[model samples]
Target chain A: MNSDHHVILRVVSKALIPVIALFGFYVQFHGDFGPGGGFQAGVIMAVAIILYSLIFGIAAAMRAITPGFVRGLAALGFLLFAGVGVWALIQGGDYLDYDALLGEEPGGHHGQHLGIMLVELGVLFAVSGSLVSIFYAFAGRVSEIRDEDW
Target chain B: MLEFILERGNYWAIIGLMMIGLYIAFAATNLIKRLVGLGLFQTSIILFYISLSRIDGGTAPILYGADLESGHGDSEGVEAVAEAGHGVADAAHSGAGELVNIYSNPLPHVLMLTAIVVGVATLAVGLAIVVRIREAYGTVESDEVQEMDLSVALAEAVDEVGETQAASGAGAI
Candidate 1:
């Protein structure tokens, strides 16, 4: 976990993490027209954090993202998703009826687009938060195994 | 027989992978190895679902011609088509009543995306449990943990039997 020993890894990961995060954002937003989506984007984003933790050590990663924050993020994402569905219900349509989301003409494409985007954003948040937290839970454990053990 | 096997080779490979995964899961005494086997099984199932979505000479399920023409290469073309009074389904068919594009089914692919995420979560939870087990029992082997549990149970049973015997002896006195 010592940063001094992994000079090359530290330098390379520092350079790559931002780009990986940017790509995750692109996938999250452009999911409507592409092969990528919330799940892919979420995993990609989580990988960046996991890589950071692996190279820089778990304490540094936890400092950067805190367990409490990630837990909140997961809850917030679920709320955003369910809130959208509830919004549709309040609009007098069936649950998750994206057409009712924007008060546009029933079955309008715009509402569907907006609803899908919001829902995917929620999924992105939930997936990334949950994954990073799970990584934290594992990394936070006290280990008797050392680098020599590998 | 050769042609038939060649044509359906993917299925054969899937079956092989599935059997390997199943064998590992059932036979491996190490908890981590069992989890790895479970992951392999999940991967093979994902591959199977993907193969089910494939169509001969089919491209992705997206609409192409109009979008290709726009040069912007965005979802605008889809909206434009809808605005032009063609329902999304109608656009896939030409006026000659023949299919212009054969698109692979996207449903299975979409469903499998959820499956993959669920599989990862399952793996993570399983690993966390294994880590806890290792911490508590000092080993990741399932047989070792079970043996330890059996010894503890036998010790507890002996203690209870001795205590009961002492109580009976006191009553007799």
Candidate 2:
């Protein structure tokens, strides 16, 4: 690869990742408001990382977003979400009843909002992790074989 | 009415988009086309769920209290109680005009958000597999690969049978 092209690719990857991540957060938070939310944001964020991998090669991208850490984060996020639902159930409420979690608020909507936020955080973690994993799996493969048996 | 258009129209549009995407996925023989179909299908479903959350005349569900008037407008409480038919006519009547028309339902939006994430992840994995397929086969056309693989399997089967017959005849001798 040309040095100039390599530099440009690196720069583009570095530049776009933060902007994409910021947008993902905005989508996740503003989801209650409009046409975006946690899943979309997570995917978009992952796509940015994938793009970086595609441009700069898998090693660089992997270095930037470590696989083991992401896997743990994703698992933790899922557990947190499941924990909330279980907590609600344990409180003598219907499985995921947000009101039970809130424990008798003025209105039940507050609990629903809180539950959703927590779930969204979980979703974000899982998405970001899965996406990075996909990139790593593909990018990790050696494209060319030097050993010749034929 | 504005409410009908926003609520119903969005649903129909999303369904239509989903069907078109699904059709492409089912019919397309090209890997990229299938991926495109998958993308379309995923995106349309996301749109569908997002649309479900919108309430006519309802603002974002923010608790700012600044635009509370423009939000649900406290009209729904009365209508809901009246609709429950607890014999509370006055409560229903008072809040009737101020009620927001089911502008938002956050649950579906949340689910769809997850759906969107899953969809993109699936697409990424699919595309990666397609890349590997293209690398190995020098083509990403499904029909072509299937035909080739089928032919190769048939040939191997025939060769195996021939060898088995030759061995049997030799044994008999």
In order, what fnat does every candidate score?
0.33, 0.33
lDDT value, residue B86 of candidate 2: 52
- Candidate 2 residue pairs in clash (backbone atoms < 3 Å): A39-B113, B53-B104, B53-B105, B54-B103, B54-B104, B55-B102, B55-B103, B55-B104, B56-B103, B75-B99
Give the alpha carbon lDDT tens digit for every residue of A68-143 in model 1.
9999998988899999999999998889999887787422478888899999989998999999999898888778
Per-candidate TM-score, chain A: 0.94, 0.85
Q: Return the top candidate by TM-score.
A: 1
What lDDT score is found at residue A71 in candidate 2? 80
Models 1 onward score TM values of 0.88, 0.68
**Model 1 Cα RMSD, Å?**
3.9
User: Which residue window of length 10 is worst by lDDT in model 1 chain A?
Assistant: A101-110
